[model samples]
Target: MPAVGFSPYTLYSREEWARLREDTPLTLTEADIENLSGVTERVSTDEVVDVYLPLSRLLNLYVEASQGLHGITEEFLRKGNGKIPFVIGLAGSVAAGKSTSARVLQALLARWPSHPNVALVPTDGFLFPNAVLEDRGLMTRKGFPESYDLPTLLNFLGDVKSGKARVEAPVYSHVVYDVLQGQTLAVEHPDIVIVEGLNVLQPAILPKDGETIPFVSDFFDFSIYIDAAEALVERWYVERFLRLRQTAFRDPAAYFHRYASLSEVEAREVALSLWRTINLINLHENILPTRQRADLILRKGAGHAVESVALRKL
Candidate 1:
């Protein structure tokens, strides 16, 4: 276990980590991963390296550990140890860089010696289409747990973790904000499958009838929650909104094209309002509460630096 900081719940100072875990043994070049995930222009966040890099290595270790355990336990049903998928769950609030962190980890974990078949499956794929949400009167709660196809998501994870001969997950298009039925992501039996989304750790929302159901996180050998203060996350949302207003929203075919040309003041207002109305509510009621269920927590500082990490004690 890593030494604790002044606080009992936190450990890993920036200076101490930088010295102990320099970015070495990374097969992926910086040029390929220079820009952090979800960051279009550029980012100056300190957590990009010091925190995420070590976290990536830690995940790799977890993958290896799971493999060891699996081999010993499944003596009868065993096959040759060529490669097995390592599914990781990445969860966080809006503007917390959960998507970015997910992409970064996918790349990092793939480059690791253990798993070259690393693949990413964002829960965005399971989000109900915009029209469907509108039909259900849930357009306002787009990212909320209720807006997703929980059954499909759970089944998808089951197949991924089951070592199925072939598994396909529906692909969701952002422009349309719907799952393209019959369109699927083909997995050639990945060595690692990283599932990223807002409520990946949420328990299965089952019917009242007495029946057992496997929650998505139940299959996750290791899960991470990217955490940040409310204020910081709000600021990031505003900044990202403004940036998108200038770029993606400008695309005529973009789903958010209506947001283009929003003035700085108007954009900030919209961002704040959305955060207060939708994102914040989801975070408080569904997302944030699941943080305790995570195996690791990446707590960010004001400047988006991962100032501390909390790992559940074995």
Candidate 2:
């Protein structure tokens, strides 16, 4: 918690937040955490029990309230009951551990008997294909807001929120560094959908024609922003890049295969350069500016452990 006064959020330390877990049961095992984690982002069961279990419980309350409101509105309008999925937007920088948090939430939320149908979608799938980006001269600006197929992404969300039984999202391959052709992820009717990405919270851009456009966050019932010091995130990014050099980069099909044979010093230099030019720029210019739009912000400290939570006040 910051020592400053007059904040829009009430901060809670890790110990204080962990006590709110109360009677929430822990269902995830160590193996489950291991499988869900990314290359450098690891989540322990203790962290889940402390940080995410309470979050899941809070989300359940929000879901129940939302359903109740939907039922009331339907009855008041004399309309038939319609089911809409509760959407959660999880946004953060590349190395801030948002992926691990999303996976953890998905696992926890599905365990609840009230809403067992949960779907996790990464907005990386919405990125324009490499060829398309190159054609548009946006290859170097990949991961920027302009680099995504926003209209298509919005339409998919619209269909989901309109109670569509099934919607398909394009598949993205990190190894190939592009949208996979002829591959799509089918999302059925889910009680909850977690959309994780680096730019989900960005505000809608106004068109010159004066037409209104809905931002992705507009459809979210709740949004979380994972945050950490910029220096720490840069270090994490460089470390992950180095680690991938020895692992994923070794694969001939990997887009980053060129870095596989580089010496440690050379690899670190390249990674640092990338961080300074691309990822950090995106974080400062686009992502971090949208943090205030989040319903909750998880602030991570050294080693990627959440130190404090700042939740929006009612």
For candidate 1, the clash count comes to 1
Top of the candidates by TM-score: 2
The lowest-lDDT stretch of 10 consecutive residues in candidate 1 is 39-48
Model 2 accuracy (lDDT, Cα): 0.93
- Looking at model 1, residue 4 earns an lDDT score of 56
Displacement of the residue 44 alpha carbon in candidate 1, Å: 5.9
Cα deviation at 207, candidate 2, in Å, is: 5.1
TM-score, candidate number 1: 0.88
Give one digit per residue, the lDDT tens place, for model 1 in 1-314.
98756432445666655454555454455565565546432434345467666777777778889888788767756766444567888999988988777777777777777677888888888888778899999999998999998988888888777787578877987654567877988877788888989999888768788686878898888888989888888888888888888877788888778878778888889889988999999999999999988888888876566777777766
Can you tell me which runs of candidate 1 are displaced by over 4 Å?
A: 1-10, 16-24, 40-48, 76-84, 205-210
The segments of candidate 2 whose C-alpha lies over 4 angstroms from its true place after superposition are 1-5, 207-210
